[model samples]
Target: MAAPPLLHRHFSNSLSSPPLHRHFTSSLSFPSPSMRPAALEPNLFISPKPSLNLSKTFASVSFENQRRKPTSFAPASHASDSEPESRENRVGEAREAVAEYLQKYGASREEANCVSSNCPSYLSMLIDGVDDLDGWNSLAAAAENVEFKRKVSQMAEQKGDKGVLPFLESIGLSLASASRLARYFSPSKSNALPRLIHKIQARRGGLHLLGSENASFGYLIESFPRLLVLPLESCVKPIVLFLEVVGVPKECIRNIILLFPPVLTYDIDTDIKPRLRSFEKIGVKDTDLGKMLVKYPWILSASILENLEKILDFFDEEKVPRSCSSQAIKSWPHILGCSVSKMKLIVEELSKMDIKSKKLGHVIATSPQLLLRKPQELLQVVSFFKELGMDEDAIARTLGRCPEIFAANIDKTLDKKLEFLSNIGISKANIPRVVRKYPELFVCDVDRALLPRMRYLIEIGLSKKDVGFMVRRFSPLLGYSVDEVLRPKLEFLVKTMGRPVRDVVDYPRYFSYSLEKKIKPRYWVLKSRNIDFSLKEMLGKNDEEFADVYIGDGEVLVPPS
Candidate 1:
């Protein structure tokens, strides 16, 4: 089994505050510690930053325009004096109102049930408001392109004389755009026409003004005409408020709405909160969740149980350590949306290379995006390595060390990196051995990483032949950076120890050692006793072995201040 998380121990010992898990809050209102659940929901916590006043931002919604007469189904003329109406009676009345409205609109029974099933949220909006049917008109009349615009403009003016007509004209929506809303928001059926007008008012004054030339209101309305009819407070405001509360800037909300309009329709309590809680439980932190939502807003509408949780359950069943699983998911939340069948196919493909059970789970934990790659793409990466002379066993071993090779852009990226090595004079025959030893080199930039490091080696007095031999022996040197890794170690050896460049060039593997912990401390310990040692003699031993051999009868030098 893998060792326990170092993070948990480090956090507990170093910090006086509570654990990060406890610091998280539900996407609902911020609650105190006592009010929080025993195990807090994942990723739902608010930031430590001051909260924004979302109520003020959303206060302009005008519900008054939606007011109308009661339902067409009047109450029974002769009521029993003994019995009062109950919840069932209200539901029945609401159902009748929906049935009558659907009938008037010439909807088939199948169509009505399908529509009602798609929007379970409609019952709540229709509860008390179903009584008002005064605004209902003929579908054909309401769909008249000219009449719809004039009526919408009049409704817009009734609220505060906002003049939606001139605003629309100024913004210049094509006729197809106006015609789409006219057909979808007909006054002849439900109260959708008036509600559509109210929703537009909510968008004004915010950055998403219908009058703004840059606004995409025409595209959004044309794409999801039904969105205009959703109740502002019950259906739309909760989502907008939740997103704002989670720190999505107001300007980005319009783009999110346009991209994933169903976010406005998903039930805040039943659909959204539960899915977010599930994501949190899987170890996606609050900050990660917020960023993921803003980037891939469609995640809000994706099936949580089927897509996200199933993949996590697979990891748990395979005994991938929780911390590794958590970090991987946090890094790539979109992996959560990959279908279980696709993941199974990937696992099966990896099995072809003899990676199964615990090792498979471990590989996934290290680089979960491997599960997101197309099986064909993964096969191509394996094929490329095999074509370069690595057998399946060698490829599998290399993959164990750096499974992120699965994410490489094989045809383009690997080719470019190999071309760089060829240009640098590393013979083609030596390339496979170097690559097998350091597969991660394929994932790096040749210009930024490989060439610069090679240039520094030649500058330091190693011949091109010697440099190529060093890389063939220890391929990882090319992966090190000139400024951070190679240069600092070389500078320390030359300036501090007075070692000549020739001595350092003999063992390029010295660049791989930790300078402060291994090189500096060990050098000073040997120097204290006037003993000289090879690079292998000084650093090749394990810690306890080195301590016994070097500090046998003398005090080791303290680390320099």
Candidate 2:
């Protein structure tokens, strides 16, 4: 037990403050009156009574008293009058005396032996000697020693009992020591180590054993998110082993942190292309495919999309397009079997479609497996639309415009048509009419024409689809095929004999001309005339003159005189 803190006492002559006076009074114990007024007080105090009697009394007693006690006090006075030793010299003598005593008996042979035996070198030697049978015996003796036990207990009390863990480990102690230290540090057996393991096991559904390498420990820390508080680098193996005992659940795992660089390899399946033709039947969505491209970005291969069609078909078969209930959506995961994140993204993309396709959303949300497959098929759909000259936005708008077409049966038909049209080269210009005239044709001729020129229209701030649609509508009035009417203009240079025509067949001029005269081909011509008269004749004989003429094509066209 610790002692109580000491209290300080203060004495002051002036007490103007009541609190100060009370504080002093409560703390101090003064002597009573009976103890006062001793003979020493007269010498100590310069009171009037003591001062007046001092000289008279001293003079009267001095001579006689001096004579009577002179011989008796001489030896004692002589001794007292001798020179006093310096404080430094006295201290030195004291030290010398203490040294002499210590040399003689302060430390006995037994005590010296004890100190020597416990010296670091001696202990190290003793430890070495205990190697084999002798070493075991010595270790046992140390373990059993009362003094050693007391020292260990004291060390534990000063520092936590956990301090013993490292010490025991350093000496290659047995599991018993580990257990003992653990118990001492955490008697309840609910320590961070065990708890971390439990948490990891609960989250990931697997245990990770620690490896001997430092990297192994790092892996353990990454794998077991809860064990972040430990000095992981020091004893990674133990930490890893502990993590291995505790399993991690799959659902709780969000992201994995890696210590080593990852290596990825891709294997292409040649058979996937034919399989992808049936993507819509399998429940794959263009949006889901688009998301996959965004997510992996690098894995956006045509082959992968083709393989994904099978998965999409599975989703399509199981999907309930009419149901918007949460239960229906929830049932998707059971049918499709995919992770939550994938399922969520798939559902979100599906929900953006018209309500008629709500069943697709429900199916995607419930089925993780379908969600996975949906991404590739989605990419394929987008590719198909793009090949037909439809941008992502255009495809989305078209899908949004016609929600009733996304039913499971209709979806398959649309997929087949898209494939057929894509193979045959249909233009996007014909899509709206085709879609409207033969909504049932979604199952047979889904492909639209590739209107690359429309992109230019869109770039100039016009909606590409709107431009294409308008061009298609006015094709007959324009007296040309929609492709020709919608064809973008090209720039070229033309050389002419005269001034350039600002406008071809100006309506105002043509109308006025028509009103005035019979219609006839109007021609403009430039003629040249040659004069026989020489320039010299104008300048007079002997003073020759020359003339020059230049044509537009950098050619000289002067007529000879």
Candidate 3:
């Protein structure tokens, strides 16, 4: 009922500002080594701000456009007596300052440190005041999203003459991007593009659409420059209206166009509607049309639909069930974007590796993105596992169990996960067994997912050694959450069920049972009957088995109404 803590209030206020706009061209470079953020959401408890390096938190610009870094994007502080610290050194010092400051303001030390180290610029923004405090908070949010920062930073770093295509300049496209468009679209050695550009500007929906409220105009133009040349009435507007008629939400029109601007180039009767019909034929229910269009608007694109048919034909040839393929498309609509030629190569490679043809359909359904991966990348993942002493058959078994391992990147995905396992006390020797058993563990996030669960386990009373053994016994134990699954179940086990925490160590699978349905209902039945049961015995039973063992032997007593 009470208002949240000051840090939470401040974060909420700063995170709700106007989205980034054009005309914010400034260069910024930070030398901090990347560190992952500890908590997705900062702790809401109140605490004093840390005063470490109180000398320099507010040295950058105040919360405004052009944002946390100043207009010049210079170092946070300067020197009068001696040379200023190296850029890396300054980032390091600021990271320490922000991490400590965040901890004092209710973030756990892990959360603060991870955030501080990952992007010191974000932490620097907390102290560096931007100009327009009321409207520029999303700059802080941008610091958290690496992709958003890349886009914004790309716009901000544009260095061009002010005299470039004034029409696009007026509507937020960077001059560099506009110039590229002019050169690329104009094959003739003539000044006709500038004239064509102004003509499009004067057209009914051309410039107006680019400048429309809520359009991601810069990103759209950068991604698909041909939108600048496409006619407003004949090409673009009809498609926009067609989407609304087809049940894509009115609000989603801008996003659909931005994602697949070439949709404007497709013929409605020949290309667009036919693809929509193909989608319907494949069991994409009428109700899911809007959601699918928004997620992968290119599902209806001309080139993608061509590939979609090829992939679907390949599925039929491979003995894949029609129902499974249909569901796979429904779940991951972008699988339509994959090349069927590459898929054939992957199937051959998989066969040589002993991957079963029977399991391939289900793998395709579960890991649709795997079809998009290069064959060399799959080999790299296989080689990494082979180094772990797994034979090709064992590797195929692991893939059949969790195909996501093959879909993942070996260096970026698997190696980092292996490091996280090592950091958490998984021995180098036993990691292969754990990997084969719980291959999903490689897909888990090190900073956000795995570390937090392990830290909570230690916080609740499990020693590091106890957790290591527990995770080996039931590899999925780390996948359980501290707040949702682990904490509530542990409380019930110790306080309500009167069982030792050692029971969890002995039977880590106890976390897998649903608390409300299986665990609590069965435990209550046992309590009413005055019978003691081990966690494994209590949880590891089917309904009929459980009823026969306990309820069949004794009536579960009912309280008087």
How much lDDT does candidate 2 score? 0.30
lDDT of 3 by residue, 23-53 (tens): 1112111111121112211321112333223
**Per-residue C-alpha lDDT of model 1 across residues 375-491, encoded as one tens digit per residue:** 899999989888888888989987887898777887678888888777766777787898788888888887777777888888988877777777777888788878888889889
Task: Please give the ranking of all candidate structures by lDDT, highest first, separated by commas.
Answer: 3, 1, 2
C-alpha lDDT of residue 510 in model 3: 92
So what's the TM-score on candidate 3?
A: 0.61
The full ranking of all candidates by TM-score, starting with the best, is 3, 1, 2
How much does candidate 2 score in TM-score? Answer: 0.18
For candidate 3, the clash count comes to 8
Give the Cα error of residue 277 in candidate 1, in Å: 1.3
TM-score of each: 0.58, 0.18, 0.61
Off by over 4 Å in 1: 1-205, 208-223, 226-241, 244-255, 266-270, 285-287, 312-328, 451-467, 529-537, 541-561
Q: What lDDT score belongs to each candidate, Candidate 1 first? A: 0.56, 0.30, 0.59
Better of 1 and 3 by TM-score: 3
Q: Which sections of candidate 2 miss by over 4 Å?
A: 1-323, 326-336, 348-372, 391-394, 397-428, 436-440, 444-561
The residue-by-residue lDDT of candidate 2 on 1-561, one tens digit each, is: 000011111112211111111111221221223312232222221111111222221122222222122211111121344444532332233323322322232223332222222222222222222223223545556644433223323333333322223222222222232333332223222132223222222222222222121222222322222232222333333323222232322221111112200101111233322332333443445434333222222122333343233334433543544233223222331222233345445555555543124445444333323344444455455455566566555655544444334332325655665544444334655765455433334532222433343343344344434443443333221122224332211100012223122221111121122211111111111113222322122112111122222123433222222
Pitting candidate 1 against candidate 3, the one with the higher lDDT is 3
